[model samples]
Target: MVLSYEPSVKSRIMVCITPQKSSRRLVERGAQRAKETNGEFCVVYVNKNSDISQDLKENEVLLELFDMAQKLGGRVSILVGKKISKTLAEFARENNITEIIVGKSLRSALDVILHGDVVNPLKKEAMKNNIRVEVIE
Candidate 1:
């Protein structure tokens, strides 16, 4: 009899970030998870407006976050889309992502009602694809 061993698949972790300083924490968490699992780490941001310069502060923060992600040995992606949740889900599927990390919603109830929730839809898509979604505070 012969015994064979097969290596497990590497985790592909995606961290979804907004243009806020708190997003750095999510990036750090993703990086840590990737390191622990010997996996790929990626940071993603979805922008609705074509002109990022419209919000100077937000743009600056996003740039800083992107730089931090790079420093942590992670790939950064800035996608333009009307729907953030759909865009994120599509990107995850295309990249063969195994896990997704997201921060707790900071939007107000009115804002959520007006714009729709990103996590729920994203979770639905992830569930259908057998992907893991983690919400961090």
Candidate 2:
């Protein structure tokens, strides 16, 4: 018997996340898709240090993010800077990432009232950079 196989090209996928109920779900979905396409996944946690007066970290979220990265066999990247949207966008652009997967924002009533509808800003950033972003609602 003769067997033949075709090699798959590994693409890069970037997914932005924060401390939200939907973050895990989004990462999992992104991982599955990455596996399907033989792609690399970059789980980015935007911790803009300069933006905040005091430098601190979200321990719970960071741990969970790393766990997801490990379980999915993905790369974990941390960007500490002032420009949240721009930082993420630049990474995607520099890496030639075609798609970004993110979870739907779970905003509180008060948050919505104060901040307006929470449309993931990354969506717009991706569009501006000519990169495609998918929200896992």
Candidate 3:
């Protein structure tokens, strides 16, 4: 019996999004990349416990992401986990994602202290997983 082999090249990328306006830019970029590479796309969102509701019609952010994915011609997935970076990276690996799209954060002392848990760990783990992470400045 002959076996067909599939390449491991990452055709799909996962982008982490929040309520921030920059997410729109990332979505656009992800869409372009997906189109150029002829690869499927997926979007991941991490929100707080109280933020989620069963109303996409009323939830603008969720709706926006879905719309972008649809327009970009890719698949979309939303994840509700507290750990942002860890969850994102795990998702990329799980879905055989090769790249990640993220927006750059304005540097602030308070922001660093608070978000170090997510940013620092994410950078290190992405390298370990052999995933390419793109931070839009």
Candidate 4:
């Protein structure tokens, strides 16, 4: 009998988070997927505006979430950009992220129509980079 060993591909999973408590779930989910695949986990928060002081409460919550991500063996990143989807996609490409986990969009239909849908653009970007995206409801 002969024994053979094959190295598995390592995945780099990124979780896109907001400054809300619900974002913790996304982080946990990303961590679980990373663990299952023996991959790396990362949590990212994108601020549309540079003025984080505009929302002190949200900033505090984000800090807590970052702490949790660190405890879960995940790297935490805070980015400032005008476009969320584009920023996330660029980060994914630069980081060689294999998969991205995001929560269902909280934007209203009107807002989406006026601003643009994050998931759709993100999905398009992911396709171009051969990256997978999971939207958790």
Candidate 5:
């Protein structure tokens, strides 16, 4: 119903979704946790630059995930950026998110070496903003 956007509002949980199977589980866990706390939940997808086909496929996945989130009484949002962790942190700050739910890292070795892992950075950023970050298995 009335989802308060204030930083001091009641618990607000944010679920970060990717094109991984674990994302679905993470969303479900986030929604259940939110319900347990009598709070609200939202799902977010970060899009990096990619080819048209890839983007289309990602959009399809996002739509499906959005439906899942909606069925669980959660909202969905999309954010486009070069740096996912930074974008997510900015979004969390702007939205006054109290908690963040993220799946385990799905990055390859090279990707990890090149861009680093999102989970650690997200956790650090969330800590600075006084938000809690939970990594779902």
Candidate 6:
């Protein structure tokens, strides 16, 4: 008996988006990397319930991200959660994401004091899952 099997291919790349200017850069870079690697591109945006003001700003950015992802032949997700970094990591693991592209935080002092920085924990979590994380400053 001869069996021909197909190799397993799970090459999905995800980008973490926020309302900062760097998000645009991150999406562009993530798309380029995905294209170069012949991988699927995805975008993840974490939404926090505490900030009503943030919601409006983030919505605008989210729309741009969606458009960007669509143009790149990819998908985008907006997750509502308290822990931004943790949520993104979980999404990556669940979606079989190989790489995560995130932009440096533009969080205000009050926001940082309230919620903490996202990039550090995100990197740690990604490392634990063996997911490559790229931080764009």
TM-score of each: 0.88, 0.73, 0.80, 0.87, 0.85, 0.80
Candidate 4 per-residue lDDT over residues 30-100, each given as its tens digit: 88998999888889888888886675454788889989999998888877789999999999988788899
| lDDT of each residue in 14-116, candidate 1, tens digit only | 9999988999899999999999988878899888988766754547888899899999988888778999999999998877788999998989999999989
Which window of ten consecutive residues has the lowest lDDT sum in model 5?
A: 1-10
Clashes of each: 0, 0, 0, 0, 0, 0
Error of 6 at 3 (Å): 29
C-alpha lDDT of residue 46 in model 3: 68
In order of lDDT, best first, we have 1, 4, 5, 6, 3, 2
What is residue 85's positional error in candidate 2, in angstroms? 1.6
Superposed by TM-score, candidate 4 places the C-alpha of residue 104 at a distance from the truth, in angstroms, of: 0.7
Stretches off by above 4 angstroms in model 6 are 1-8, 50-58, 108-114
Candidate 3: clashing pairs of residues: none
Candidates' C-alpha lDDT: 0.87, 0.69, 0.70, 0.86, 0.83, 0.77
Q: How far in Å is the alpha carbon of 4 misplaced in model 6?
A: 24
Q: Is candidate 1 or candidate 5 better by TM-score?
A: 1
In TM-score terms, candidate 1 sits at 0.88
Query: Which one is best on TM-score?
Result: 1
Candidate 3 per-residue C-alpha lDDT over 14-128 given as tens digits, one digit per residue, 9 for 90 to 100: 6766665568888888888877776666766765464566545466877777787777775666666677777777777666777788877766879778766565677778888
Worst 10 residues of 3 by lDDT: 1-10
Best candidate, lDDT-wise?
1
lDDT of 5 by residue, 20-39 (tens): 65678988988998889888
Q: lDDT score, residue 12, model 6?
A: 74
Candidate 1 has its poorest 10 consecutive residues by lDDT at 1-10
lDDT, model 5, position 87? 87
In terms of lDDT, the poorest run of 10 residues in model 2 is 1-10
Clashing pairs in 4: none
